[model samples]
Target: MIKRALVILAPGFEEIEAVVPIDLLRRAKIEVVVAGILPGVITGSRKIRIIPDYDLGDVLEEHFDCIILPGGAEGAENLKKDIRIKELLERQILKGGWVAAICAAPGCLINFGLFLSNKFTCHPSIKAEIPLSRLEENSSVVVDGNLITGRAAGSAIEFSFEIIRQLVGEEAVKEVNRSFLSNLPMLGSIRKE
Candidate 1:
């Protein structure tokens, strides 16, 4: 039922964190839409310019099956300040839609009061922002309920894989894993015991 995955980008977003998942999701034949926090171009922390497909002001809250947030200090801050974005996250979670954050952006999830008791991992520097007990150290990705998180940019690929698995299923994950030759040390690479 999830045909499209919507990614929200703001100024100062970590370019890798935002782009990797978009790329991976697109490769899986999933529709991706990059939504801007505002109505203009947003620059990543590394100075990568992203032209969003839709602006926040113009998007309907119900159009996306998933919403992803990529971390960069300013990007996280931008998402937090938008009440509509916050409301969308909450509504999406309640509707059983996938919601994800990577790196420092997960702090936005925490600040929105969405991270309590969720099993998640974030950049070590931002760990204190989340109130999760079952924290995994040096983890690439963690999924708790409808919320998924990745530690940092270094984990972006695996984080994206985790999202792919969640959206499309293990078969798709296996297919992608085969195509990418993903031998990286991440949760997705581990064979289930």
Candidate 2:
């Protein structure tokens, strides 16, 4: 059976956190549905605009193998404030599906009382907004039970790798990483000699 993943996009989402995972999951042959909280285009924190495949209302009743939430301060708040997202998350949890959140989005899980495991990681800046029982330290990504949480934008690649590893398998991760790692250039800029 084909694995289906749902990515929820709200206005001011973190583009890297959403796009990287969506791309990697597709490469792993997982069917991904990008759902926007609003109609038409959803804009990112960096002002990058994306047109979602469907509105959130369209997929509320659909069953997904995994549901992903990407973090930006405003985006996360928008998601957290919506009772519908909370209801959707509760349903996903009850069905034993994986719940993944990155950056500020993890805080949404905490606010909704959806943290099945104590260990989690989120954008450190969000630490002040919510009270955390325990946080997994020095990790770009934390996977406790069916819950997966990632740090900031810098960790998006590793975050997606871990997600693919979960939804697919280690072998698919190896195959994707082999190609991705080989193509990534060194961090520093070139010198015009």
Candidate 3:
């Protein structure tokens, strides 16, 4: 069976956090649906714009193996304020599907009371917004039960890899990483000029 993933995109989302995982997941043959909270194009925190495959309303009834949230301060705030996103998350969790959030996006999970007992990681700035006790400060990514949280933009690749590892497997991760030349030993034996 093909794994399906839904990635929610809000205005001012982090582009790298959104795109990197989508790209890698597709490479692993996962069906990724990028859904915009609003209609049409969504702009990133860094001013990058993306056209989502579906509007949130259009796919609310659809079932997915995973739901992902990419973080930016404004984007996370938008997600936090959306009742639709909260409902979807609750349903997804109840269905035993994966819930992944990165950077400030984890704030949305906290807003929904999903992180009360889960160890998670998020952008440092979000620590002030969420309880410090539940935050895993030393990890780039934290996976507790079906909830996966990533630190910040810098952890995008590793975050994606962890997601890939979950839905797929270590073999799939090895195959995908091999294709991207990731996780390979550096040729330190070669000297550069």
Candidate 4:
């Protein structure tokens, strides 16, 4: 069976973090539902607008293999304030489904009391907000049990592959990576940051 994923998109969500996973998951043949937290078009932190596949209310009763949260400071705050997001996340967790968050979105997991003792990573700016004991600073992505967290926007691709690996398998990840030519390095000469 194809894996199904629900990616929650709130206004001010990080565009890359949201899009990369959705795109890659689709490429891997996972059914991705991009749901807006509100009724209409949602704008990203950089002002990119996207129409969601469904509104959060429309999918409240739907089942998914994973629930994904993309982070922006404002977006994460919006998610944190939504009782419905909390409820959905808790329900998914109770059913032993995967819960994934990136960057500041991990704050939502933290706020919802879902972080528990799970090791996770998030944007450096939000590190102080997460308990030091639970932070895994060395990796771009951290997966503990059914919980998956990514460090920042730059790590979105790697984070997404990890999600695919967990839901599908390493073989699926290799196939997707090959299709994207992700195994190949940059075409041009490397430039130092």
Q: Top model by lDDT, which number?
A: 4
Model 1 Cα shift for residue 117 (angstroms): 2.1
Backbone Cα, N, C clashes tallied per candidate: 0, 0, 0, 0
Global lDDT of each model? 0.82, 0.85, 0.88, 0.88
Give per-model CA RMSD.
Answer: 2.6, 7.1, 6.4, 5.5
TM-score, predicted candidate 4 vs. hidden true structure: 0.93
- Per-residue lDDT of 32 in model 1: 90
Report the backbone clash tally of model 1. Answer: 0
Q: Which stretches of candidate 2 lie over 4 Å from their true place?
A: 129-133, 182-193
TM-score of each: 0.90, 0.91, 0.93, 0.93
Better of 1 and 3 by lDDT: 3
What is the per-residue lDDT of model 4 for residues 1-193, given as tens digits with 9 covering 90 to 100?
8899999999899999999999999998999999998989999999999999999999999999999999998899999988999999989999999999999999898888885888888999889878988888767888888888999998888888888988998888888878697753322111112
Cα lDDT tens digits, model 1, 1-193, are: 6468888988899999999999989887778998898788989999989899889777754477779999988888888898888888888877889888999988888788874677778888888876656566566787777778888999898889888888887777777777778787434532222
lDDT of 2 by residue, 41-83 (tens): 9999999999999999999999999999999999999999889
Worst ten-residue run, lDDT, model 3?
184-193
Please give, for residues 64-168, the per-residue lDDT of candidate 3 as tens digits.
999999999999999998899989999998899999999999989988887478887889998876677777867788888888889999888888888888899
